[model samples]
Target: MKGRTTAWLRKKAKRGFRGYPIATVAFYGPTGDFATKVVASIFPDEGSDPAAMERWFTQDTDVRTDAEIGEQVIAFVRGHAALSIVVTDGIIGCPHEEGIDYPDGTSCPKCPNWAGRDRWTGERVH
Candidate 1:
């Protein structure tokens, strides 16, 4: 599965991706303790199939050591924020403004208001 996904990513790269996208899963314990983490970042040389990746994530699985912990993490993200996790609790004045679009409609990566940066902390997002 990893190889297949990687190949897809390579294909995408050949086509072109503005930035390398990735997926990370953070697990927690039954009591809601942060347990472990997994990141599928080593993609193939080119591009990837977004739909396939989405299916892989949304599909039911028991790969985690603690199923309950996984469930809790999923629920927390779903309830507290959008599917994209943005840690804003401790950042000053966080929950920063949205990313600004360039005159051509693309996001301005150099903009101070870029969504990828934690406005309050000036920290780079993962």
Candidate 2:
């Protein structure tokens, strides 16, 4: 069941845009290979910012495959009555927020693996 919840979530997302109260799911980690953090944001309506945002983190396991975390994420989206769910296909970037976790102009000190890498493609950038 490690991947069951993730599969379910992705399946839901594949249904396409249904309506308002959309939930966006994104994963982050030190490197693009393993997701240590997951962020879920809820938008109550179109052209509006997320009204609620929640984050889950794991130190010893990938959050993507963690059954408990996956359940919680599913529950959170359901609780918000989200009509649409959008999940990122893969890890997007470092788990650390640049301005919040480190100096805005500098790379994350804790995640050198993501430095100079494109978050979307995971490719080295010039």
Candidate 3:
């Protein structure tokens, strides 16, 4: 135990960073090789999964505000044991702008403004 981490562990311990299940960062090892591993406990800020947000924005019709959208997304994600998703375009319908033909919430014969959604994928980028 002359130069072991466990022996050092038994000594006075300094608080380490706290974000568990975090993305692994590469670092040079004692053998001069790059490696990755999760060796500590760090409380995550509950990562913002864009995929989950996409799912919620597509499925749930009750969410309107960006805050509500994000909250519902996190809730839905936490409910599932695991989930994986990918959207081709991160931005959906172009918001009302100069050249875009996106339906403004005003004259939408299909849906409401706050509930403004992409009818195809049902993702509200507007």
Q: Pick the candidate with the highest TM-score.
A: 2
lDDT of 2 by residue, 11-106 (tens): 889999999899999999998889999999999998999999999999988888889999999999999999999999899999999789999999
lDDT of 1 by residue, 32-123 (tens): 22222222222222365432121112223322434444444444333432223222112232111225323443434433343455434546
At residue 42, what lDDT does model 3 achieve?
20
Clashes of each: 13, 0, 5
Tell me the lDDT of model 3 at 89: 18
Task: List ranges where model 1 is wrong by over 4 Å.
Answer: 1-63, 85-126
In terms of lDDT, model 2 sits at 0.91
* lDDT agreement with native, every candidate: 0.31, 0.91, 0.28
| Candidate 2 clash pair list | none
**Candidates in order: C-alpha RMSD to true structure:** 14.6, 1.2, 19.9
Error of 2 at 86 (Å): 0.7
Q: Candidate 3's residue-wise lDDT over 58-119, tens digit each? A: 22221222344434333443343222212121222222222333444353232233245542
Which wins on TM-score, candidate 1 or candidate 3?
3
Question: Which 10-residue span in candidate 1 carries the lowest summed lDDT?
Answer: 26-35
